[model samples]
Target: MPNQAYLRVAGLSKRFGSGENAVAAIENLSFTLDEGRFLSILGPSGCGKSTLFNIIAGLMAPDSGDVTLNGESMLLRPGMTGYMLQKDLLLPWRTVADNIILSQTLHGVRRSKALDAALPDARACGLETMLRRRPDELSGGQRQRAALVRTLQTGKPLLLLDEPFGALDAITRLHLQELLTDVCMKKDKTVLFITHDVDEALLLSDEVLIMGSQPGRIIAHYHLPQEKPRTLKTLALPRLIEIKGEIMQLLDQEVKRHDPHA
Candidate 1:
């Protein structure tokens, strides 16, 4: 609502191919994220969530739109924000500690200094013991933990995570969700996360945006409470339950609209 939102996307539109074979990824999509707010986007597959993220991360340019961070246009700037994918993408040969500090290493920060800075986060993520091991030596959850530390080590204020915990087991996912919230919120990082799970969105986001398909437009938005240190128990609250139901219904409607037989 303010003139200079922390992150703002205006009239975003992206399409693939041309004319007859063209497909609309996102159409006139727009949203604003305030500083230090954690926001999650819920949408069906092929709803342009990743496409939007790519644009925001400067990995890809939108056909039409503008992405701004702190009133500065981010159109051609890559690496201005932290971007993490579902895959850990850690180098096979690098040790966990080395991998976690890769971003800072590339940015001209000394390895020793980066390691010193990342030590606290590595311990908090339960990666203190595994830091000496390589990615192949770690379990899926451990790898994700290493990846998370790596993302945070970038020291970028805005983080774009695409299903960072989606591949882990239920318990691991839950633990990492809490870890992510605690680390990001305490550090005053603004997060825009993409997840298909309604409960994950509800539990983690300060606000949730439900996206519709076909053209990938926002159809619903829910502002969640400011409660902190939320756990699985918090999802059981009546208000969250009701909102979850509403989100489910809206997603179901979007699915049926895109595929009537679904």
Candidate 2:
């Protein structure tokens, strides 16, 4: 009845250490992202958000459960989806164009073809003039743009973004958020975004999932109206404001629960 999920995580659990020192990072967590949908995850610090990203990205294996795309298992393997991390992680030695096409080259795509595919993305992200420049020569926002271009160049159906704009200044963060939304919408890309910023999640997500700490699990889900393009003005909407307050209260309660002195 619901739109068939393009990506699904089922009964996922993960733990670290042993016996007394054992810590459960994620426990029985599960969710689905529909095709061409944008989903944002929000939670208190140390809520296993990045752990979930790593599991979905196939960078790490869960102690239990599986990640599936189109009903195929995507476990214990990397490169199943395009991932943009908190840091740009661009190679300083490589030029902007080279970095943008790195994924293509790794996937055995010919250099010429990779460049051809990445050029337009680079231009779209305003990196056309700096194509030949090394990562060190680019500004923070520019480096992040190049990283995003590189991720998208992989042509993966699913995109995993873990606070890609968290390191940038406020102005640059907003600019990149808008740029990311525009690019994803144009491409009809499915995205799973993780962020600590409530405003960012509300502005960009088709739906927002709130998580609680100490064995992270979904505490609430909010489906946002997608009829209008999300922008800074969306933050001021009464509905968004109401939802933001609700999420903030939940997050505050989570923090207090974990604080010994509270």
Candidate 3:
């Protein structure tokens, strides 16, 4: 909301390999992500959405880029930000509660204390009864719920969601989107999500950032400007349809160029 950006990304560029083998994922891309808001990154496949997230997460560094968090350069701090992959990535050996507390344990939090601390929040995610059950015992939606709860338990300011609900059914995905909105609001988190689905971006993002293909770069930044608790009925509104049409047009153009036969 202020002049100072919560997350500042200047000249963010990523390159893979060298010379003939080289490929630029994102070339000199720059963007500012504000605090306490959700920013969605939408792009077709191979447009470096995940690559950008990895760079921001500190899992990978850009060849020529700068990332600053809260005015200071972003350092490689493991728990400062939480990242949830496309898959739930739960450990089958551990119980639902155990998986949530795993990060705390790595941070030197003892088992009993970890469980005691994580119990209430995990329960809120509907994993209370399943804390004693294994990951193998849960449904797809349940696994995702546990994964979401686990990601939240870390208390990270930056939540990097890489299509967290992409694998679920349409009905389940809708519920999870609402659930995610509720969780993010309650936690006051700054979230950056990479999702291929346009409707999902429109539904959840405070601002949707579309990226270009090949040498990935930001193409457009559209603010939803809608209040909290955006529902399916809201999607039917004229403004929503207009925005959706705009995004769909961009997507259609990209798809035609990328794959004419599709």
Candidate 4:
């Protein structure tokens, strides 16, 4: 049987400013993410990708339409999902372990219990030795790993990632991609990821949605083959290459459609 929809965004619309100066950032956008599946959104810059995420994260409200999690409205409820943005956003004063358990601490989980619960994830991500180190003491990749642990500690059924690895170096990015895939699968968390990289989207996603500019809207959807969990080795497969080319073509078409001169 097909997987049930765990998250749904239907006819969502958002506009900035008003009257003649108003800009429609998103219009009639709709999509569904299945339970435990990873879905990636791809589009050109200023195509409302971040706008869509902000709306989904409850940081902003759409002018129309609805966002539902587990069949319930998610409007204005920021805690409904765990969100990881482009930056790790670690607290400078906190140690790695402290930062990882920050969410639990906020939720009244005792510090001792939160740290204990975070230990396994820290170890799994290779940060066991640096648990007590502050964010400034760690490398960029290490900080991002710690941030991932913190997101996981929230224990939310859904995760919203907005280009979390976009700032990392290529090698570190690939490593984190692998790590994220493993963690999500093992934990059975549903993910909605926004990214500009086609290969990254293809590697990390079960389904990829391509958005168009000028009032961002999903113009194409591709359901990727998931015979097995994707890894760096998956990049070498002919099917992956084919899908990448197709996605690139679609994106190019979108660009040209918006800018005829190009």
Compare the candidates by TM-score and give the number of the best one. 1
TM-scores for candidates 1 onward, in order: 0.97, 0.96, 0.95, 0.96
Those runs of model 4 whose alpha carbons end farther than 4 Å from true positions after fitting are 1-4
Best by lDDT: 1
- Each model's backbone clash number: 0, 0, 0, 0
Write model 2 residue lDDT over 2-62, tens digit each, in one string: 5557888999999989999988898999998889889999998888999999998888999
Cα shift from native, residue 197, model 4 (Å): 1.2
lDDT of 1 by residue, 124-154 (tens): 9999988889899999999999999999998
In Å, residue 185's CA in model 2 sits off its true spot by: 0.4
Model 3: CA > 4 A from native: none
Better by TM-score, candidate 4 or 2: 2
Looking at model 4, the pairs that clash are none
Model 3 lDDT tens row, 169-212 = 99889878988999898888999998989888888889998888
Candidate 4, residues 96-184: lDDT per residue as tens digits?
88899999999999999999898898888999999889899998999999999999999998998999999999999989998999999
In candidate 2, where is summed lDDT lowest over 10 consecutive residues?
225-234
lDDT of each: 0.92, 0.90, 0.87, 0.90
Pairs in steric clash, model 3: none
Off by over 4 Å in 1: none
